[model samples]
Target: MMTIMRKSPINVRAAAKEASHERIVQAAARAIRRSGYDGTGVADIMKDAGLTHGAFYAHFESREAMLAEAVDRAGAESNGFGARVIAAVPAEQAFQALIQAYLSKEHLAGIETGCPVAALGSEMPRQAPEVRRAATRRIKEMIDLVARQSPDWGQPGVHERALVTVATMVGTLMLARAVDDAALSDSLCSAALKRLAPSDA
Candidate 1:
């Protein structure tokens, strides 16, 4: 005879609670990127997650705890994008594709969903230790991803080269978005492509 396994009431409630926690973290991730760290509030995050403010304490110990989780989620989303770009092309062309994708018009306009470091780097130092720690860990992973893409992957200077590349891309995009002139914005990105990716970049 075949037997069916049923979840206990405790397990069902635990799953529901876990789902709510995930919803809050996802919403907070987007909120921080969209509105900056200082601008995102617990009430706003909870509301965006379709939960009440009173329920927030059930999911997190403090505002900083939620923000820390948000940082991780945001970093993961951005890193996932980079990973996909590298995977979508041939090994020899992967690095160029990542550079091109990072500076593309699509990414340029996608502040809330793009790289967390580029979006929140300036504000990172002021965050709680846990939040900053989370961001720092993700940033290291991002740099590693870039470095591993280098043709000289395990070479002596590849890590430094990856550092410069990431810095240049982030700075260029930040400047491009800072300017109000559409021409300058396009020019900034074009100039970066000229040096970073060139052809398809």
Candidate 2:
């Protein structure tokens, strides 16, 4: 006779908890992305996830906690965007690849799937402290990556230059999304990229 091995109940419970938490986070991210931070509510997010509001406290302390998680998710999603471009091109060409990809017609039209910085930048300053902190960290991380691609920038004032670059990218993308004229959208992206382009490039 052979004896069968059984899985630990603790491991199963942990996996279930992780899956539930991830589902809630994803649902919150979608809700917040479609509706700005102030416009969305805990109930709405819970409803979207098909979970009860009572269940929320099991994973987070309050709405602010969930918002922080959502912001972190959005930030990660936004920053990871440049990875594909950076991988395909040399570091010298990385910035150009980013500019082109970000300014492209497809990106301009795809608001739901586009960069969160471009989608939600105007709303960041108004978010709760925790959410704002997450946004700040993500923004800094992205800037550091861009500065790394630009060797001449040095390390001292990367923050300022990164702000300019990020601002240009977000502002132009927002303007492109707001307008009805295709030509105007294209021009806005082109002009912004030119302004933010590195001096050496």
Candidate 3:
């Protein structure tokens, strides 16, 4: 016979608060992606998270503060996905694997969970300083990861090349998503993949 243990009131309240905060941040992250930063609202986020709007202040001081955390969360998730792709492939194939995964149709249709760099790059300049800084840091981390897999790794220009490569990929994806024609979207991604990672083509 085992006795069941119950959480103390203090522990229960703390746990509930922590869970609510996580829900808010996660909802914000998804909402911001579905509707750009300027479009996502605190009330909408709270509603999506299944919480009352009045309870928002208990977790975040302001909407801007929530947006910053949302941006950071999205960026971290993007970085984590890239890291997993790189890790699963051989060192020599890591770059190609990353490019393929990034430009795939699956990623194109899944914007809500896709790369924040491509989704939010154009809007970064218009966001709060904290949001921009958080995104910039994550973008740099992504570039560095690509640079490590470059043929010119350790060479002086590898970092610059990595920047160009990442920029091209992000730009291509953005353009692809903006177009109305399905063929055009496929063409954009195909062209970028062939041009940037020809060896993998």
Candidate 4:
């Protein structure tokens, strides 16, 4: 005899709601990355998430609220990837490995799945206060992650160095993406990587 597994009605509804919420956030994350925060529309995100526009309020209180969550989600995703990259290499070489991976051409081309700081940094200043605060918090988290891998991890100036390193990486990637010339783009990334980690060059 074959047995069937049946979910309770409440369980089914709860699961469906969770799934829908995930879709909305994921869609918003992608949309905001492709388009700046101001450019992303609730209707477009809902449509991409396979939901109608009217259902947005059921998942989020407002557009700004959804964007704040999305920004946090994007930062978490990037930070998680960075952690994995660092963890995959030996501790002594982890920093250089991360620099290489971050400055690679692949990362330069992958805007949708790339670093949110590089993609949205410029637009962040104009965003709502809550959204800007969320981005700022994530930026600090990223800087802290880099600081932990530095030689002067516990030193006072280590965080400042990490801040500079993160800024250089994000700035280089942004400039590389802005230019139309392929060679120039690659050169910009290479120059930044070399300056930041000469031994890795």
Score each candidate by Cα lDDT.
0.90, 0.80, 0.89, 0.90
Model 3 Cα lDDT, one tens digit per residue, 22-65? 99999988877888898899999999899999999999888889
Shift in Å, residue 148, candidate 4: 0.8
Which residue runs of candidate 3 sit more than 4 Å off their true CA positions? 1-6
Model 2 C-alpha lDDT per residue in residues 50-82, reported as the tens digit of each score: 788788898899898898898788778767877
Give the Å error, residue 48, model 3. Answer: 1.1
For residue 122, model 1's alpha carbon misses the true position, in angstroms, by: 1.2
Error of 3 at 18 (Å): 1.3
In candidate 4, residue 150 scores what lDDT?
86
| Top of the candidates by TM-score | 1
Candidate 2 or 4, higher lDDT? 4
**CA error at residue 52 for candidate 4, angstroms:** 1.1
Number of clashes in model 2?
0
- Cα-lDDT of candidate 4: 0.90
